[model samples]
Target: MTTIVHNWSMIASGLLTTLVISVTAYAGALVLGSLLAVCRVSPLPPLRLLAATWVTVATNVPVLCSMILLGLGIPRLGVHITLLWAAVVAVVFSGSGYVCEAVRSGINTVSKGQVEAARALGMPFGLIVRAVVLPQALAQAIQPLVNILIACLIGSSLAAAIGVPELTNVTRALNNQSGEAVLMFLLSGLVYLAIAYLATRVGSLLERRLTRSQGAAR
Candidate 1:
């Protein structure tokens, strides 16, 4: 307890670091994942194969292994990315596979009739995807997308393995220094719980809003 009180600043900094990594990684996942989703549904065979291969590789590789490779292997090849950025890159690439699948599931839920109608209207492929597919697909995708974000939050702890001073790392240090493993871990868990609760609440609000908009459209 005394250690916790004295080291509040360190713990807070760790929490902030965890949040930064999770948020950045999730943002990158969304961008890359969205592109992959598009590729999976594209008319071209080569693009579909490329996207599928990326997702398969990213999904199959363990995050720790990927993190080690990103943090150490890349630098050995002459790239100079920091440990933090390396962790972010690993997370982004790894999470993108799940994101792509989730988005593709949403896209599948969109009515084929609407897509056909758009095509009948002579809309270009790009226009039809943007105007007809993405909106409803995104609405359907929201829950799964939020779940992935939560996974990202928990997975950010893996960054500690690569020497990032994230929450788990801070908690480990506190435990080592004070032998207050129980208290330090309890506090660390509480921070994660609080962040997860907020994220869930935000996701729920957005889901409800999207649902209402979809209903109004009908």
Candidate 2:
């Protein structure tokens, strides 16, 4: 308790770093994932194949492995990469695969009849996707995407291995210094739990609002 109080600033800094990394990575993942979802559903076979390969490789690779490869390997190749950005990119790369699949599942849930009707009405593919498909698909995808966001938050801890000094990293350092591993880890866990719970509540609220809106539109 004394140690935590004394190191409050460090904890706060670490928490901020964790939030920044998670939010940045999740944002990147959302954009990339949405594109991948579109590519998976594209008429172009090559695009579909490429997206499929990306999803397969990204999803199968461990987050730590990706981080090590990007954080260390890229630097060795004569390219400058900050540890922060490396962690963000690694998390984004891994998280995007799950986000893509979640969105693709949402896309699948959209009614084929509606798509056919749009086509019959002479709507271009892009227009149909934008005006009709995506809105509905995104509504269904909110929960899954929220789940991925929480996953990203937890996965941010792995950045510690690459010396990113996120929450877990700072907590470990504090433990090493103060010899209060249990208290340090417990506090860190509580912080994570609190953030995750808040995210879940927000996601639920958004899901309900979207559901009500969709119901009323029907």
The number of the candidate with the highest lDDT is 2
Residue 185 lDDT in candidate 2? 98
Q: lDDT values of the candidates? A: 0.91, 0.94
lDDT of 2 by residue, 102-179 (tens): 999999999999999999999999998889888888889998999999999998999999999999999999999999
Model 1: ten consecutive residues of lowest lDDT: 129-138
RMSD of 2: 1.0
Across 163-187, the per-residue lDDT of candidate 1 in tens digits comes to 9999999999999999988898998
Look at candidate 1 and tell me the lDDT of residue 165: 100
Write down the TM-score for model 1. 0.96
**After TM-score superposition, what is the CA distance of residue 189 in candidate 2 from its true location, in Å?**
0.5
Candidates in order, TM-scores: namely 0.96, 0.97
Model 1 residue runs over 4 Å out of place are: none
- Candidate 2: which stretches are off by over 4 Å? none
